[model samples]
Target: MSLINRLLLLLLACAAPLPATPSDLPLKVGLIGLDTSHVIAFTGLLNDKDNPSHVPGATVTAAYRGGSVDIPASINRVRGFTTTLTEKYGVRIYEDIAKMCEEVDAILLTSLDGRTHLEQVRPVLAAGKPVFIDKPVAGSLKDAVKIFQLAEDAGVPCFSSSSLRWYPGVVEVATADFGELRAALSYGPATSEPHHPSLFWYGIHAAEALFTVMGPGCQSVVATESSGAIVVTGKWNNERIGTLHGIRDGKTSFKVTAFGTKAIVEQKSGGNYAPMLREIVKFFQTGKPPVPAKLTLELYAFMEAADESVRQGGTPISIPDYLRRHGQTR
Candidate 1:
């Protein structure tokens, strides 16, 4: 070949993009449920290379369509989400969670029904893979506690949370230089799903926001319910108070007010799932949970106490007492 031709070929080779090496490969993640919109949203951000907000180093490669057949909300939407994940994202659909776990490095338990989370997560934990359980970790507080306990026993890193906890404003409030927080109030919409507990369905968003600012150590909860709203007041171990307002009527938004020694801060949620997904990827890579198991348990206890308080006619329910009654201790 002519020298000029050889030089041209060399230049072309140099300009060509190199294939990604093993070290540069994205983590293969598996989704366990296709009943919720999160399955599509999360997969879109992780798998779409053209997305501006894409969090690199992870891709959802497979999913299992495990939806509750009895619940119309679950059964109705499963087919659409399943098709999107499979057709749009090129994600392989699995017949069961166990089979999907075998092919992925980590798991996302995104089942819409909290009642199925415990069973869905058992095999994943047995495989010793990290998992992120979506809100309403379980249908009841006892089941939620049991799921965490199983994860602990299996020595697998597992955590549950609502996306509301990672809202830009809410996160800023928790970490800002607002001095020691004396009290806090969080408000959000609460739409109940009859299959689960009243607050577990949608009120979890407000509860998560409240706990994000207040931290743990909720001593007791007093709840008052009416047609328009349900107000839950929690007293902390240190005597600090926090309240969650679950609005059932009119327009709704997620907002919080924190009263601190140095400054008072009011935060309005700018909802985005990318931030939390980034944290989830980090947790998978490191095998450490971003949120501790203890705090999550306490959060569920607070929600359960609120339900119990309403049942007892707006009386104050002790957190410790509620936990003990449910076969859990703090």
Candidate 2:
């Protein structure tokens, strides 16, 4: 037998067989968003009427609570989306999250703001189903940690991402064997979701790209905003340094660069969504979390603590103490 086959046999020698693709089977996917606009992308997907191209084999099937009623208008964007959702996806907006979770095998929680993720997603986790959270996973590091830990303990997978992370160049750089990567620089459009979570929600698109390639163990980070431009500097084990820029009105609208002692690589994969979805499908097939939930929580740890510093007159905060106080200093 070939070396590959022998290795595979040895690895799965006593493991259980994987599941058959319920790919073509009628899978029910629910979307939890106050504004139907969030689900509109999938609703009008490829003009196929069923979002067949992306979610192949699985049907979005049902969408609930197509409208937001209880939340204050100051925080709600659901009004503008009702018509599109009803006309495009035939989704019904329900008030109770428990009821919503019971009806679907999987959920797409696209709440209007990051602050609302914890309240909305907890029920979904308790229901024991997989979830895909749109960026800005949670409002705080503590909350993000709780969310992942809950899902982890429950054996329910949750994933969140940005299109930029999968851009061709970023993927290529990620494959590098950088020896002690000294620094990484990633740039993206001005984050519109800053009010809820400054660079917390959207910044991860760039941060996650770096975090993935860096392979975790980020010690702390500091960010400075000058005239609405965010300049983020971070350290990993106090050895390698990285920067992430969220700039407005910049012509060089996209870039991700990684550096090493022996090699350097640069690539630009701007605004790609297909890769994000493809990864999710892979997670379902393998029944595994898409990325290191622990690592993701750590990145959130950085963002949350950094934001606190920003609020405290640019004072630096130690993420380790914060995590340790919460008993999460892993």
Candidate 3:
């Protein structure tokens, strides 16, 4: 070979990229929805090392652009968020969800439309990948129950939650030594979506916060509408009472007040996505869900029962009956 040709070949070899060592690479995460801002927020937090709140260990490598056509909020923003994920984060957009699942270690179902989550996550569970479904796990309580069952049958780790559950104050109050917890009240903005049951859209955040301090076992629920807000009262099997105010009139914010035998603590601030992302990464890495499926089922049942109360003209609705309608024994 000519001397100049040999030198050119050596230069090419020097410029080649190095293969990533196993430990040097992060866990691959795929997104199943692009309609919500979470697509960009979560991707940046995971992929951008320079980010101040960056959560290490998992990186979003692929996403499927799934959006609901009937929902304007969903379909309209899908393209914009999809572009941001592709251009800014260098995330590969896949047209097929199953194909995307094959390429990633875990999945984030962040679709804005609750009605579409069950269908969107079907492929991810089938691929045996752990998945995190965002707020309002499903369009209905029935679908939510089916989702957990499906995930269990598939032997895939799956969890769904609202970021509000981790609000610093909420966490503090929940874990505080408030001897013999009595009852709690959580209030937040609850914008309704025609396609979903009341509280499934925005009120879910407050519902989650309520359950965080209250801890399931809610036996009955009743809802009353007044001054542009829906007020829900729940009776726990322990004889503890919890109330939720889905604010719709004005000045909406997230606040949780826990009453106990010793003290009354409140969380008056909003939530951040970073904390939830950290938990998601930990779950993806450990293959264990932070939130229990049974607890989640009860939470959804509580919300659905509130809706049922409204439909029955403020009659108290039994939580167990709500779950039973979905064929859940609990």
Model 3: what TM-score?
0.92
List the candidate 3 regions with Cα displacement exceeding 4 Å: 1-24
Question: Which consecutive 10 residues in model 3 have the weakest lDDT in total?
Answer: 265-274
Cα lDDT listed for each candidate: 0.90, 0.67, 0.89
Evaluated at residue 75, the lDDT of candidate 3 is 95
Q: TM-score rank, highest first?
A: 1, 3, 2
Q: How many residue pairs clash in each candidate?
A: 0, 7, 0
Number of the top-ranking candidate, with TM-score as the measure: 1
lDDT tens digits by residue: candidate 3, 1-330? 999999999999999998998666799999988989888889988999999989999999999888889989999999899888889888998999999888889999999888888888888888999999998899999999999989998999999999877878889979988788889999989888889987898989999999999997999999988658999999997789999999987998888888999988877566688899999999998889999998998999888888889889999988887788896753
Give a tens-digit lDDT track for model 1, residues 1-330. Answer: 999999999999999999999667889999988999999999999999898889887999999998898888888999999988888989998897888889999999999999999899999998888999998899899998899889988999999899878889998888878888889999999878888878899999989989999998999999998988899999997779999999988899999889899998889557789989999999988888989988988899898789889999989998878887876753
Query: Model 3 scores what on Cα lDDT?
Result: 0.89
- 44-90 in candidate 2: lDDT tens per residue? 44224344445443345455453334435423566556556666656
Model 2's alpha-carbon lDDT is 0.67
* C-alpha positional error of residue 316 in candidate 2 after TM-score superposition, expressed in Å: 4.1
